[model samples]
Target: MTQALVDGTVIRGHGVASGHASDSPYPAGTIAMQQPYFAALGLDLTGLYLATINLDIQPAQWRLLQADYTFRALRWTDLHPPEDFSFIHCQLLWQAQRYAGYIYYPHPATKIQHFQSPRMLELVLPWIATISYGARARLIYRAEQIQIEPAALL
Candidate 1:
C-alpha cells in the first residue's frame, strides 16, 4: 500500500522479513509503524515484522545474523539501527542494534544523496544512553539510474 514519503523516498524494507523472536519481552517487531514525521505525505503503514525461521545449525545462524544486521535497522525512529547488543535487563525496554550497510554516491545525472558513516540511532529515553545506532549509508546496489514512476506524480 502507498503511504507517506520521508524526504522523498519511503523506507521500503518494512514487512519484508517474518522471523521474529517468539519469546522476547518486548514484542518482536513492535515498532514497525511508528513513523512520527512532520511531512506533507500521509502514510497508512501496515504492521510489519520479521519472519519466523528455525536456527538449527551454526552457519545458518551466522547468515541470519548478517541479514538481520542490515534488514532489521530499517525499522526504527532514527537514521541508523543497532546491529549488535548485550542485554542487561529485559524490563527497561533498553536494547541496542549495531549499524552496517551500503550507501550510494551522488552522480551528475541522478543527483542522489550521499550516505555518510557514523549515522544516528535515536533512543526512547532523552539522555544517559551510551549506545550508538544508525544506518551505515551505502551506495545503492547495482548503481542503476532511478526513474520516477507515474504513480508518484499524484
Candidate 2:
C-alpha cells in the first residue's frame, strides 16, 4: 500500500571522506542546531536514520528538479554559517513514510568531500537496514515531481 515518489537504484558513492561526519566535533552541535527546526516542523528524530542513501539519478531528471524544486538554506555554524558550508532542508519519503532531513553538498570548507557528483542527497531515517547496495528504492520528495532510474552498472 506504499506509494512511490521516484524509484532509483542504490549505488556506491564516492568515498572521499568516509564516515567522517559522525566522528567530527560538529555532529553534536549540528544535531543540536537542527533539533529546533525538526521540532518546529513536527519531525521525530527517534525514527531518523543517521546514514545516507546515495541514489543514482539521470541528468534530465536532475535538470527537471533544478527547474522546479525550491531549496531552503540551513546554516549550522555558530552565529551564522560561512557561505562555503551549508545544508538544505527537504523531505524524503520511503515505503510511504516521510522523513524530514537535508541534502548535504560539500563546500570547500566542509569536512566531507565529494567529487563524483555536484550534489548528493542525504536522508536521515530509521530503516536504513531495509535497503542495500544495488537495491532499488523509491525516493519520494514532497516538493516537485521527479523520476530516477536505477544506475547502470559499470
Residue 151, model 2: lDDT of: 40
The estimated TM-scores of all candidates read 0.18, 0.47
Worst 10 residues of 1 by lDDT: 59-68
The true-versus-predicted C-alpha distance at residue 100 of model 1, in Å, is 25
Candidate 2 lDDT: 0.46
TM-score of predicted model 1? Answer: 0.18
Instruction: Give residue 138's lDDT in candidate 2 (0 to 100).
Output: 58
- lDDT tens string, model 2, 1-154? 2233555566766432233354444444444455456455454456554445676554413312321212244454554443232334455555566656554433434333244352234444455556677775655553443323334421
lDDT tens digits, residues 17-78, model 1? Answer: 22144543334342332332201123222231122111111111110111111122222334
List per-candidate RMSD values in Å: 18.9, 6.9
Best by TM-score: 2
Q: After superposition, how far is residue 56 of candidate 2 from its true place, in Å?
A: 1.0
